[model samples]
Target: MKMIKTAFCLGLVWGASAYADPELHFVDLQEFNAALDAIEAGESPLSAMESYVAQASPVFQAYAQRYETSAASIADAYSERPGYYRSLPELEGYIRLREPEIVSALSRLEAMAPAGEVVPTYFMVADQRAGGTPVLAAGAAGPQINIAVAVDMIALTAETDMSEFPGGTGGRAEASDLPQVVIHENAHVLQLAAQGGLEAYRSIYSPEGGNMLAVAVREGCAEYLTYLASGWRLGDRHVYGEANERALWSEFEAVMDAPPFSVPGWFSGRHPDHADWPAQIGYWMGFRICEYHHQSAADSDAAVRDLFTLYRPDDLRPLAEAYGASLSAN
Candidate 1:
């Protein structure tokens, strides 16, 4: 149950009685270290790992429920890539080194987010096979959304081949992208909080008549905010989208309301039309939509809040169209 807690006074600007103190839990590293030690000692890691999960901090336990954190799943993952598992301890060291900066980055959220919102952040070395990032889970204590980061995956070297991974090259990032991913995902947590709650936010992504534009704009908003906060972009999508804006928007508009996996796979992995293009180009379009809308809004704070508050296609279509119209004008 070891975790670090910090509370920041966001002042009285956002019109709140109080703001929830954000907590960062590094208990996952403790669990991994204990389990790794047992493995090296020629002892079973299952017992230690299980005990750790049972006694884990509330945040880590919530993350465990979403992903396969069982010893068997982890052992299987280790069996596949023993070298990767071994690298985690060293990565744990890396996370510790960057912890201060990570906390500082997360602290910036106070101004952007609604007051009294609690975002519990967790850093963990978990099973990479589960594909952990932007990790948000619902718990009994309101929306228990924790940003569960896979330290191992983020620590992967750029030179390492990711072609065999789930999203291939399209759905991955290197160690350097860690700060941006954390901030981007943190923005998502606040966005979900603003858009009702986790369940409400989840409803928008339903495959049944789900609007890809909504998903795109939602992610785009986060991407845009991440850039504003951390000055980092998600892969090369922003650059690629900027260079080929007109053509991409032309293709994107037709399928923006289609299911997320409809055609070009804009938000999903692998763009079918262009093999060389980066993955999730929908993110770029979404980013642009939010950027244009935010820039045009008279009230900056209200404009930023609107990005997360209205996630439906009906609400966001106007913004997208306005951006599209502006594109034509340009």
Candidate 2:
């Protein structure tokens, strides 16, 4: 229950006096870890899971209800994964080791956040498959964020031990990057708030709608904002390097104006081998567009504010084209 006040500063997008720092509620990872320990010591894993669910924060409870499943089912599924439960102690240790770093990172992010009405609740869980990865993290306007710590630590360790997962890009392995991931997801929370709250944000950006522009705007701006807030890139190595980034932008420009689903294939985790592009290149593309918009704007702060508040995809075309022109000129 550590409460870090929002460090108010002048020149913020929402003004210095606008929003107070939201209370960050860290879940009791120790209790959860002990539950896992009990499971390892021969207690019924499901029973342990049920106890956890009973005591979880409202955000986690909502997450469970959203999937139309009980928390026990979700916990059971995670336990079913090979080496999942066994990894809990190691994961807890990793989190404890990095607690200071995580807090510091969050402080940096909060410093750059706009004043808003919603204060988000933050927590950690043990689901590897919760979002897209075992260490999946997600954020929304309720300002709720959940990180699956154990799975993420395992993945991080695996990546460190091995160069990269088979058919996976092996970048972003350092445990130091964990805070940046949290910042990226927090950026989503801010974005959702900017775009008329959670339901509206989901309607336009959810995968079911397949709105490429929206997805690009949503995710790209999030990644870009994370950089602005934390000075770190969300993904692997290639994106931060100038040469590879320029090439990827050039390719993305060709289809930047394509219809919603026209170039959807390009956004997949599996990128084309011939291009030597990193997976999820769409994130990079959107980031570049937002970057150009920010750099080219008359008021940079306003440009960033618009990134979160603006919902139209077509409005971003000029920004993308401007960036493309600069790339070609170079």
Winner by TM-score? 1
- Write model 2 residue lDDT over 270-317, tens digit each, in one string: 444534655456777777778788888899779878766665656666
* Model 1 lDDT tens row, 213-315: 8778878888888777667785666778889999988988887887755666676556656876676788788899999999998998998888767766688
User: Model 2, residue 69: what's the lDDT?
Assistant: 42
Computed on alpha carbons, the lDDT of every model, listed in order, comes to: 0.65, 0.53
Question: What TM-score goes with each of the models?
Answer: 0.79, 0.69
| Candidate achieving the largest lDDT | 1
Model 1: lDDT to the true structure: 0.65
Instruction: Please list the Cα RMSD from the true structure of every candidate, rounded to 1 decimal place.
Output: 6.1, 7.5
